[model samples]
Target chain A: MSIPADLKYTKSHEWVRLEADGSVSVGISHHAQELLGDMVFVENPTVGRKLVAGEECAVVESVKAASDVYSPIAGEVVAANGDLEGAPETLNQDSYAAWMFKLKPANAADLDGLMDATAYAAHVASEAH
Target chain B: MLKQTPLNAKHHEANAKLVDFSGWEMPIHYGSQVEEHHFVRNDAGMFDVSHMLPVDIKGEGARAFLRKLVANNIDKLQTTGRALYTCMLHEGGGVVDDLIIYFMSESWFRLVVNAGCADKDLAWMEVQRDKLAPKLSITPRRDLAMIAIQGPNAAAKLWAAMPGTRELAEAMKPFHAVVVGEMFVARTGYTGEDGFEVMVPNKAAPFFWQALLEAGVKPCGLGARDTLRLEAGMNLYGQDMDEGVTPFDSGLAWTVDMSGERDFIGKDALSRLPRNRQLVGLKLLDRGVLRGHQSVFTAQGEGEITSGSFSPTLNGSIALARVPVGIKVGDTVEVDIRGKRMKAAVVKYPFVRNGKALV
Candidate 1:
């Protein structure tokens, strides 16, 4: 339910935050984590790997089911959260703060193409039915 | 609209995440499923299992009727409040459903059957009653609600929440039940942990649930229940075995009483059928989650995982699979997970019990 004003989100619930280095840190949205429930394993995309927008790049598994994490924008993965391998529940605790991977956007303008906070909130609201 | 249980409002008030289970609107979790699973394993947790149906059989022919209907010998239930877990099967030896029958008296018995299989089971039971024991009367008790309190501290929590229950249930061993007023407290649970499955009047369900909550028993949902039962090596009626399979193939041969000379519903067909595939436990040697219907490749032949999950108790993935009869404990098998063959070891099931991992 907490959709930060600064972060952009994908329809699939991935959140993108523009970091200080111009590289954007990406993770699943708070709503995504809530729906998935208590993540037990997070398979983060490898660093230095190139990804296309909307590609299934990683997996986040919960006790109930396994879900594919899609890339919000095309980019080269700069860093993967190694901490997730040992403690995946951190994502469930604070999804916005626990970034899954850092990406150097292939086209920085692609960030604007994703849904903003208002749009993402509406998208989530529409899904409830 | 999905069917709702008597405690549906109580679950919503607890902020449960509701999901469509079979035809019923049931809670999948109240919060973190892993935490709920741990609560039931370590402390105490309660589940609103009112979706299941309770049927009562009464008359002089009640005992005689069940003996011919189920695969397991019901005559073994000699003492009052003694329960028997058995599979009701078809003439072809396929499982109709698995149920728990409690011997309340010489002429009266209680049966708790799965929610999904209730209607079909009733119809099947009626058919058998008309053909065999026409004198018995079977009545479905829809006015009752069921709650399962599980874990190491489950009994203490129950005693504290409902006063005087300790006196009635303290000495009750596993598979035994005691009637305290209108509540039927059975020392039985799907989870490997010690607990009781209490049945009470539908109107009192909310009050009982609130009392348990105040007693420090956490509210768990079906998600944790499935994981706990899976780790305990319990067979789920539809997932682990169904109308397509018999008890011998579902890791439930021990529950089937074929040793007796008495004939049961599926006895004749089970005797003639060849036991080719058998259920075995799987411990993932490598990373990844094992899910139901996933293909399994043994040294002898191919098979399928009946029920699989990430076991919270063991902190690893485990599964129950039906593989070729040649596969044994300590053998290695490859599971086709998302098109990749992942290495897994075949081990004796109950991967976890009493907060300890056996494999």
Candidate 2:
């Protein structure tokens, strides 16, 4: 429900925060964590791994089920959240702060293609019905 | 639309995260399922298990009818208010459902059966009653609501919430039930903890649930119920044993009551069929979690994990697998976790009991 206006989102529930630098920090949305319940394990994409847009780059598994974390846009993974391996529940606690990985965008313009806060909120609302 | 329990609106009011469970809209959790699981393990917790069905059998021939209906020897239930856990099976020896039968009197018995299979179970019981005991009356008590209060301190906490229940239930042993007016309290639960499953009239359920919450018993959901049951090595109805699997292969042979003189519905088929598989517990030596339907490789042959999960108590994965009868305790088996063949040790279940790790 807390879709920050400064952030962008994908239909699959990944959120992206564009940094001052060229890199963008990406994590799952608050809605995503709520749906998945308590996360037990998070497998993030390795640094330097090149991913195409919408590629399944990582997996976040809860006690109930596992879900693939898809890449919002084509990019090279610059950093992986190693802290998650020890405590995956961090994503459940503060998903916006506990970014899964950093990506150097392959096409920076792809960021505009993702849903902004207003559009993403509408998308989430539509899903309820 | 999914089926709703009598307490469904109450769960929604408490902000429960609801999910579709076998066509019923049930609460998976309120917030954190792990916290709920830990709460029940450490303190008291309550679950609105009204989705489970309670059927009442009344008549002069009630005892005789149940004697031939279920696999367990209900004749053992001589004392009033005594409860027995038993399996109902098909003619092919496949499991129909597992249920708890409470003997209130010679003419009246109460059966609590799983929610998903209630309709099928009721029809089956009706057919059997017609053929075996035409005088018996079969009544489905959907008008009742069930709540399970479970944990080490559950009984005392429930007593605190509903005064006078402790004195009434204190003398009752495990698998016993006592009726206090409209409230029927039973000293039984699926969780491996000292607890009570209370059945109250449908209209009074919400008030009782609120009282329990005010008494500081955490409201747990089905997600925690599953993990706790798995850790306790209890067999889930559809997952562990279904119409495809027999009670003999599901580690429930003791409940079959084959030695009893009374002839049950599935006795002849069970006696004639040879059991080639046996259910056993597996403790994973590897790092991954074990889950249902995972293939298991043993020296004898291949088997399947019927119920598996990460044990919050053991801090590792454990499973109940149906393996070849040749396998023994302490034998090593390989489970296909992802693409890796993980080594696991076979042992007798339950992996934990009464807040202590047994294996």
Candidate 3:
């Protein structure tokens, strides 16, 4: 799958979409779901939880193993994807559309520090070795 | 380089996710691992198990040789077509590998062992054969490949795929096998369901696989195989028990026959060693997945999970753990999952059998 040129990508395989209201919608990238096949469980960050950049915030579990979903930027979670806890396979189907949580960024400048689509795609390809 | 089975091209044709399992390039799933697991429980599914090795022992002393080489007694295999599950152990009672021995005839028996331990197991068996059963012909059947058709509709699909097998296999009981032309079909399986494990010539495996697929039996892979066997309370050889643990410590005491004065390779060591840890089932009361090598805190002491996974049948996380013998069923235990202690209940396993949850 091609990386979305509009969204900012993280080295940890998360995609960040800047919303109109200054909140950021966060979800795992398509490559992440392809690596973790057949998701079974998901736990999103609770609303109102303060998250620091690089901190482990949410979790996604496949039939094989569990992985920590790290926060891409310092933020406070305003809303979480409630449907994911019961229907984790939604992430496997369309990870880009299945946002896990929405966060209000503590510092808007932090978004500039994230990787662009090209850099993130190159990073993913380099990790193949 | 990873090894490929006879059905490698077939799996690729189906667009399976090929993963490395014990150095073999095997499919983890066709599309979804969880879906394949449910297919085996509710309908028919076939698994390519050619990675496992089958050895044939043919001689006058075949039975006598096996009687001393394994932990289980073969005297119980009075019937010619009977199949016995047993553990080949080292001199110190640690398991070398667990295998199934089929009593084909008075002078012929076949043993199916694990893929990862095949080389070591064959060496051990060959050494035992040279010293004790000198005239016995021990041959590894690499010329053949194995496929296991499992689940509720497994027998029906097998019958539909192979027209002549129903007559030879209809009245066959569990733990029994029948020779049908070039195929050796056994009424046995790792999943706790009615099925057959068929051994076919390497050249015929893909055709037979296609026949079964045409008969509506879907292809399942190693990922589903692990979870299904785990839910059935079966042990994975290296994960649950190895040369470091005895059969008694790994929920396989029933396979060990101590009825008579049978001095198997590990009997003396088993008799001399102290009974310390025991295997039990654990049902997670909290959220999150249970994985192997997690620490378990009990009233007795700390133990470790041998095999753990999210059971698709149970829709809950379950595990087989080696804990202190003092811990009883209905007791509560805490599992350290990723540094967090999660509440779990101790329960008797075979968590799901015949498409039903028993825990």
Candidate 4:
């Protein structure tokens, strides 16, 4: 529910924060974590991996089911979150802070295609009904 | 349309996350399932089990009818208020349903059956009764509601909630039942913990639920129920065994009274079939949860996981799998988890009992 205005979001419930260095850090949104319940395992894309827009690059598995973490923009994975491998429940604790992986955007302009916090909030609200 | 239990409104009021389970709208969890699981393990918790159907059999021929109806021998119930866990089967030796039958008297017996298989079970019983014992009366008590109070402190808390009922319940042994006016309290539960499954009149359900809550019994959901039952190594009817699976393969051969001079519905078929597979428990040596329908590869042959879950008690993944014969304890098996073959060790089940880990 806490969709920060500075961050961009995907319809698949991932939040992308575009850093000043032009790389985008991605993690699942608070709403996504709440829906999936307690997360037990999180598999992030390896560094240097190429990803296309809407590509399934990662997986977040809870006790109930497994969910694919789709890439919001075409990019090369620069860094994967090592902390998450030890404690996957951190995503459930604070999703926005626990970024899954960092990606060097293939095209800086692709960031504009993602929805802002307000638009993403509206999207999530619409899906509820 | 899904069936709604009497506590549906109450669960909604508590902000429960509802899911459609076996054609009934039931609460899967309130907020956090893991928290609910831990609560029951350390303290007391209650479950709204009104979806489970209770049928009262009454008549002079009640005992005789049940003797012919179920796989487990009912002659063991010589004393009143004794309960027996048994599986009802079709003529083909496949399990129809697993149920708990409590003998109140020679003419009065109460049966508690799974919610999903209630209708089919009732119809099957009716057909059997018509052909076997026409004088017996089969009454489905939809007018009653059930609640399971479980955990280490569950019985004491339940006693505190309903003051006078404890003395009578305390006198009763495990797997026994005692009727206190309109409420029938059984010292039984699906969880590995010690507790009581109390059945009361439908109208008094909300009141009793509230009273138990006031007594500090946490309201647990089905999420905790699954983890607890798995830890206990109890076989879930539809998941572990069904109309297509026999007791021998489902780890319930002991429950089938084949040795006694009693002729039940599935006796002949069971006696004739060759037992090729046996159900055993698996402890995963690798990281990841073991789930149902996962293919298990053993030294003997390929097998299937019947029921699997992450054990909250052991903090590891465990499962009940039906594997080919000759796979003994301490044997290593490979499980196909999401296309990856993971190693697991086969061990004796009943993973936890009386709040202690056995395997």
Candidate 5:
């Protein structure tokens, strides 16, 4: 799957979409969910929780193992996807569509530090070999 | 640098996600592991299990050698083609390996052991054979390849692949083996499904695997195999019990024969040891997945999960935990998943069988 050119990505495989209201929607990248096959349980960051950049804020458990979903930037979680509690497979179907949480960025400049679609796509390809 | 099975090329052709399992390069999944798992439970799926070693024992001392070698009594193997599940143990009562012993003849028996423990098991067996049954021959058949076709529809699929072999396979009881041409087919599997574990010559394996695939048998992998076996309440050799743990604590005491007059390798040590912990099944009451080495908190005492997975059939996390012996079925315990303690119910296992949930 091609990386969405519009979204920013983290090295840990989390993707962040800058929203119109300055809050950012965060979810795992398509490649991340593909690597971790069959999501069984997903625990999103609780709303109102303050998360530092690179903080392990959420968890995604697949049939094989559980992995932490790190926060891509310093932020406070404003909302979380409640649908994931009962339907975790949505992430498997379309990871970008199934956003885990929305965060209000503490510093908007932090978004520029993340990899662009080209750099992220290159990183993913490099890891494959 | 990794060992390749006979079906290695076939797995690559199928675009399987190959992973380094122990020292062998084996497929972890073909596509979606969940889909592969569901295929095994609902229809049919096949796994390349050639990495596991098959040792053929022959001689007049074969039975006597095995009688003193394993915890389960070889005396129970009365008929030809019958199979017995047993644990080979160290002198300290710790499990050397868990294996399936097939009574092929009075003087000929076959033992299939875990791939990772093959060398260790053979070395241990050779020691016993040298000491007590010097005449017995233990041969590890690396020339053979094994494939497990499992699920409710497995028999029909196998028959489709190997025409006219249906009657032979269907006639054999569970845990029974039959030789059809060059293939040694056993009505046995690690998955808790009606299936066959066929051992064929390494040269013929890729062809047979392709034939089965053409017969509509989905190619499963080690990922599905783990979930299926965990649901079946089967113990994984290295994770569930190893050289440091006894069979009594691994939910294999029934396979151990204490009532008989047989004197097995670890009988003396086992008889004297007091049982403190016992293996039990756990169904997650909370959301997170249970995994190996996770701490278990029971009223009786703290314990640990030996083999745990997200059960596809049950749609929940399940585990085989070694807890205080006092814990019984229906008792609720807490499993420490990372930092949080999650509720899990202790239950009798073989959690799912024949496409149905038991617990």
Candidate 6:
């Protein structure tokens, strides 16, 4: 239930962090990884690939089921976390630390359109029922 | 509201993630499904299988009625307490449901059917009972609750959990049930491990579950159960086959009894119809996990995967598929997994047995 106020989130459960280099790192949220429970495989979008907002650019498969990781905003994938290829369960250990991929935003202003910690927390609550 | 088992509270207390399975609110996993699967293979684990119903058939013509109702011959049970794994078929050769019949006496017998098909099975049994043996009593034992404790050390843990009942079950053989007071303990399990499927009254389930937990038996959910059963090469009732397919093509032909003159339901259809499909196991050589409903490509023709999962015991993906009859073991098949055709090898099933890999 740790929603770091520093990062932003999408309704589909991907969290985005604006790094010091102006690039954004994206990964599934703690809630998403918790629901998935025990990751078995992680497939990141190809590096240097263009992505549209809300596009399914990655995948996170757990022992229970597979889930699509949607891109929060339009961007070009700069780096895919090759580390996850060997250890996908690192997300279960620490989701925020295990970023799936990083992107160079198409429009940095689009970050404002995404939900903050409070809004995303409410979005997660709305789904419980 | 979905149905809840007597041990539902226990599952919640153990911090289980609950899911709606076949109209019943059951636990899919306690915490980690893969970890639970391994624990059951290495040690002892227990499952609350109360959703599955038991039917007690009692009367002078009980055995005679069952002989006509199911596909496999019940005449093979020469002694009391023996259990036979078989399928109940419709008027045609299609499987109505797969069940285990336990012979308690000449006039008394018990059957355990899948949870999802309990109502339909009960209705079918009643219809057949009225026509064949009006003097028979077909009773659904919903009052009883069942729990399966399994693993290599399952017996020792069970003996430690409940005292005094050990001596009654100590000398029991596999596929046999010994009733002690109100508890019916069977030396059979869905997992390939050695253990007992103990059935007791609903009120006593909580106590037994607690005792077993205190004895260090880890609580497992359906998630682990599915993987374990898949590894053991056991067929699920709905996912594997239904009223549209018979046991002949569902890897259950050995369970069908055309060996004797015993006339049963769907016997003529089984004899007359041509079985051009066969169920075989698949070992994935690709990266992704194999799952159900995926299309399979074979040298003979097209096929479909019935059940598939990542086998925790083998640390690889395996599946059961229904393919054209010509497919043989060691043959290669490609499975369409998320639109990607991955190479998989066709092999004999029961991929893992007795806590060891066979494929």
Best by DockQ: 5
Write the number of the candidate with greater DockQ, choosing between 2 and 5.
5
Query: Which residue runs of candidate 5 sit more than 4 Å off their true CA positions?
Result: none
* Candidate 6 lDDT score relative to the true structure: 0.92
Compose the digit string of candidate 2's lDDT tens values, residues B185-206.
9999988988999999999999
What does chain B score (TM) in every candidate?
0.99, 0.98, 0.99, 0.99, 0.98, 0.99
What DockQ, on C-alphas, does every prediction get? 0.82, 0.58, 0.89, 0.66, 0.93, 0.68
Model 2 regions more than 4 Å off: none
DockQ of candidate model 3:
0.89
Q: How well does candidate 2 match the true structure in TM-score terms? A: 0.95
**Candidate 4 TM-score over all chains jointly:** 0.97
User: Per-residue CA lDDT of candidate 5, range B1-359, in tens?
Assistant: 99999999999999999999989999999989989999999999999999999999999978988989999999999999999999999999999999999999989999999999999889989998999989989999999999999999999899999986787778899999988888999999988999999999999999999999999999999999999999888889889999888999889999999876889988999999999989999999987899999999999999999999899999998999999889999999999999899999999998998889999
Instruction: Give each model's whole-structure lDDT.
Output: 0.93, 0.90, 0.94, 0.92, 0.93, 0.92
- Model 6 chain A: weakest 10-residue lDDT segment is A58-67
| lDDT, model 3, position B111 | 91
> Candidate 6 chain B — worst ten consecutive residues by lDDT sum?
B308-317
Model 2 misses residue B157 by how many Å?
Answer: 1.4
What is the TM-score of chain A, computed separately for every candidate? 0.97, 0.97, 0.98, 0.97, 0.98, 0.98
- Per-residue CA lDDT of model 3 for B25-72, tens digit only, reads 999999889999999999999999999999999989888899999989
lDDT of 5 at B245: 85
For candidate 1, write residues A1-129 as lDDT tens digits: 569999999999999999899999999999999988888888988898999999999999988789999999999999999998889899988999999999999999999899999999999999999
Candidate 1 regions exceeding 4 Å error are none
TM-score per prediction, in order, is 0.98, 0.95, 0.98, 0.97, 0.98, 0.98
Q: Please give, as one word, the docking class of candidate 3.
A: high
Q: Model 5's CAPRI class? A: high
* Tens digits of lDDT, candidate 2, A3-119: 899999999999999999989899999998888888887788899999998999988878887789999999999999999988888999999899999999998999999999999
**RMSD, each candidate, Å?**
1.2, 1.9, 1.2, 1.4, 1.1, 1.1
Which residue segments of model 3 deviate by more than 4 Å?
Answer: none
lDDT by residue for model 5 over A34-53, one digit each (tens)? 89998999998888999999
Model 6 residue pairs with clashes: none
